[model samples]
Target: MTAWRCVFADGPVDGKVVLVSGGAGAVGRYAIQFAKLGGARVIATVGNAEAAASASGAGADLVLNRHVDDLATAIAGFTGDANGRGVDRFVEVAFGANLELIVKTISPNGVVASYASDAVPEPKLPFWPLVMLDVTIRFVLVYVMPKQAHLEAAEAINSALEAKQLTHLIGRTLPLASIVEAHEAVERGDLGKTILVLP
Candidate 1:
């Protein structure tokens, strides 16, 4: 959290319009709030109204429905661009699903910070355009977290929570016995924070 907050809130996140695809999920939720805290207009995309509300409530300036036929077009609309290049930064969850559009939407010298890029499809790179604009791509790995890192993340989270600036969508809480159901619930794709009940 500290590193993310530093890299975002106190560092790269300021003065930029940031886009968060899958922005209603756990990581995205915090990312939105963190971005807002440091003064960034956030464009969040969700799968439904529930997610939209959650993201908007969490301080996203704009929310778009991912189910919309043209997700990239919607982003362009928000950026006030007919072709994209309005965004200054992007926090992407699914690169294969979103990179092509994000690349086009970002302004010159913009960056794409990717946290998770699981199976979506084969990604095609626009090497020509990227070379022209000098856009940068970064991939974040969560496994590197240490105790000190967790402490920083906790502080950032607490700061947002204390300021009443953070909002999250919690689907359900199940006891350990229902772990199977919990796993299946996660597959629903619309759920967030399926917290397990500890004894």
Candidate 2:
């Protein structure tokens, strides 16, 4: 909710073509549902078939297998265009790793809301191409968002929850005794949320 409402920080999502990278993660899954709740057509990219299934279950209109598929072509096909110009808003996770491909698939004036960029801490921006396309980049960190934005995001999330439009996906749940295991699972890149629960 915070990422969707604050990171994107744009107007209504109605009829927009929104692309979500890392669609199997907690934030990505929530973003997918939030976008759908706002009436946007969502396209999610996942690393594997299992992740793809998770994204599909979260209400993505189309799920692309990022490991094997050409993201540009996939976006083009999803948008009914041979030309790679469909994405209006992009929620990026592997921003550093996929920036070039993201730029290629996004439409003019499109916005990219990114959180993580671990792979490439210092990516060289495509100044000319981004300038030509008028793309907007927004970076979000949950802790740094303003209090008012947090309130609004909370309200938005509550509304979605009340409407039964939002649900958290738990890929694995571990007892408190297995906290180390929980961390290990996360480190191993397990799909969805890995929760450590107390009895």
Candidate 3:
């Protein structure tokens, strides 16, 4: 909810293109659905065919297999432009690793709203590329968000959940005593979300 509203707050999102990276992950999955619900065409990137299926199931208009496809070329074709004149909003997960690609693939004045950048804790950003595009890079960390924004996000999330527009994919569930197993299941990427029940 916050991802959809905050990233595209500056402009209209209806009929726009939203590119979600790591679309099989928890956040990406919801972003895909939210973008679709908002009438935007969604293009999602995934690590494999299985993840591609997951993204597609989440209502992504196009699912790019990053392992096999040329991402830049794919974006160009998907957007119907020669220069890959890219997406209006980017819901980024691997911000550090894909920073350069984000710069190249976002439209002028686009927004790259990222929540994670663990790959490069201290990344050296490319000043020129960002300045040239006049883009906005918004980092979303729920813990530090303003109270109002947090409340809005929570309300939006609840609405979506209540409407059945959002769903959690629990890959595995184990009792609290098996927390170690739950963690291990999470490490095995295919399992969507591992749950440790307290009882």
Candidate 4:
């Protein structure tokens, strides 16, 4: 629901340059797939080599390490938006942390859909820059989204599943008896999703 809401709910993603931050994470992976399936050019930012690989596997046209890459230059070069505006839509994970980069790389009138901001819960925005660019900032919370939005996401997910376009990255599968171990893996920030099966 979060991915669908970020990628499809706002507007047409087809042919747009969509940027997904933390593309190796669960939500980021789905967002990348959904944007690509929607006919958009997708770029993703990862923190490490494993994450880069994961993002690439998920069909991101380009995956850059946010910690290492010169995001502004790389994004501009990729989109050929020399005037400092490149990304058409941004699926943001760290809204506060990436605010500077987003302001520098986002095209005028671009939409930024952000889900999490744990790092900076009370982030201050560069109000004038965003306002000057006429950017739209959307805060998404799956639990509180409108019923219609939920229905739309469910239908879209079902369609993708039927078409076999959606894929799951299961990092580990364990018997329900090892639920504690599974929980620990997640708490350790293990990559991919962990599933616990009932005996």
Q: State which candidate has the highest lDDT.
A: 4
> Compared with the true structure, what per-residue lDDT tens digits does model 2 show for residues 1-199?
5457523477778989998888878789888988888899999999888999899999999999988998788789888755688889999888889888877888899888888888998888988888888998888887888887788888888887888877778888889999999999989988868888889
Model 2: residue 70 alpha-carbon error in angstroms: 2.0
lDDT per residue as tens, model 4, 132-191? 999999999999999999999999999999999987789999999999999999998788
TM-score top scorer = 4
RMSD to true structure for each model, in Å: 3.0, 1.5, 2.0, 0.8
Error of 3 at 17 (Å): 1.1
**How well is each residue in 1-199 modelled by candidate 1, as lDDT tens digits?**
6225323632457677888877788788878878887788888888888888888888888898877747677667777876668888778888888867776688888878776678665577778887788887776665665666567778877776798776667889899999998988888764578978988
Best-to-worst lDDT order: 4, 2, 3, 1
**1-199: candidate 3 lDDT, tens digit per residue:** 5465544445557888899999988789888888887788999999988788889888899899888888888888889856786788888888888887787788888888888877886678888998798988888776777787777677767888888887667777789999878777777665377878886
- lDDT winner, 1 or 3: 3
Candidate order by TM-score, decreasing, is 4, 2, 3, 1
lDDT score, residue 23, model 4?
Answer: 95
Judged by lDDT relative to the true structure, which candidate is superior, 2 or 4?
Answer: 4
lDDT of each: 0.75, 0.84, 0.80, 0.93
Candidate 2: clashing pairs of residues: none
Error of 3 at 103 (Å): 2.1
Q: Model 3's lDDT to the true fold?
A: 0.80
Q: Using Cα atoms with residue i matched to residue i, what is each candidate's TM-score against the true structure? A: 0.83, 0.94, 0.90, 0.98
